[model samples]
Target: MLRRLALTAVVSLATLSAVTPAATAATGPVPLPLPLPVLQDDARARLTITVSGSEDSAAEGTFELRCAPAGGSHPVAERACDRLDELAGEDEDPFAPVPEDALCTLQFGGPATARITGTWEGRHIDTVFSRTNGCEISRWNNLIPVLPNVR
Candidate 1:
């Protein structure tokens, strides 16, 4: 009985080892998780800035801005791209709007308005900016060449 038990145990072990490799092979190799920066490398930033209500025809026209290999109709593409990269490195969202509950000075900058639509850091952006009030004006200025310096 002792010999029979040892033989059964040996057979069971062999069977388990043989099935393990087959099961693993059937499932295929496991994929490694990509690093955060590696995943972010695929993200692209492309935007279209359209300004209106400004007397300057230069500032009123639509312009394209592409980063991560900057090339577009924007007057200062390199500077704009650098600014965006700086913002990204600082963990800031360049297209973020002013908070509604925040208090702002009651001052009208001008009628100059801009609409920025496209993708940034692989995220879709469709936001409007205007120099209507202090908050809005500040928001518009923050983007500088990205939105055209209408101030």
Candidate 2:
């Protein structure tokens, strides 16, 4: 009788071991595909802007704008989208550096900095903006609608 009980215990242990992995595998979460872009043509972009300046000024915000619809969290979404459309129309790169020989004032616009990362016209964009110099300041101001709160 003892031998028979031991045999039953061994069979139960074997059954549990065989079923455990299959049950765990079946219960595991299934992988899902990443969501598609909001716009098919890539005319939309989601931007996160962080603003910081001299000892006193600091702000941050985010925007998700689509040119065709002209919408997003930006305070001036329409204007921002228009500005971006203009850049695309002119075949100009907003993130391009200012001319090396261009003259600028010796003024200081503070140490404000901005980082823009998103998709533009089907292209991935990652750029930084700052008021450290004349060119950078121009770049920062040119993108005003998108960085509205940065003064």
Candidate 3:
């Protein structure tokens, strides 16, 4: 009787392992969407920035961007991909490895047409980033300081 029970348990475990992949594959990886940054071009627009990663090397995930003051003191702006009606549970969070508060968080989103924009606060943002293999992927620093009609 004990032997029979052990065999049953082993079978159950094996069955579970075998089925899990199929279940996931049956659904397949959800089509991850990208939310681009907000950019306005006008005399009063104040600020504009652009980012890209849509060259095919991007992973599936969200992109949050920050528009803090270049220097002095200022608040930060945040952007998130995926909406309530979109695929959240199935997301892989391409931005996983990087720190949320990382200075480069300023640049994020899809591999293509992933633009972001926000008004500056004061002066001196520690870093600026350019998208890489993925939306959340970033590199380099572009410290921008405020000046008179700097543009």
Q: Across residues 68-144, which tens digit of lDDT does each residue of candidate 1 receive?
A: 78878999998988888777777667688888897998998889988999998778999999887888998888888
TM per prediction:
0.69, 0.59, 0.18
Clashes of each: 0, 0, 11
Question: Rank order by TM-score, top first?
Answer: 1, 2, 3
**lDDT of candidate 3 at residue 97, scale 0 to 100:** 42
Lowest lDDT 10-residue stretch of candidate 2: 33-42
Candidate 1: give its CA RMSD in angstroms.
15.0
lDDT of 3 by residue, 53-126 (tens): 43443321233333321221211221121121121244442213446555543444433433324432222223
lDDT of each: 0.80, 0.66, 0.33
Winner of 1 and 2 under TM-score = 1
lDDT for 87 (candidate 1): 71
lDDT of 1: 0.80
CA deviation > 4 Å runs, candidate 1: 1-43
Worst 10 residues of 3 by lDDT: 142-151
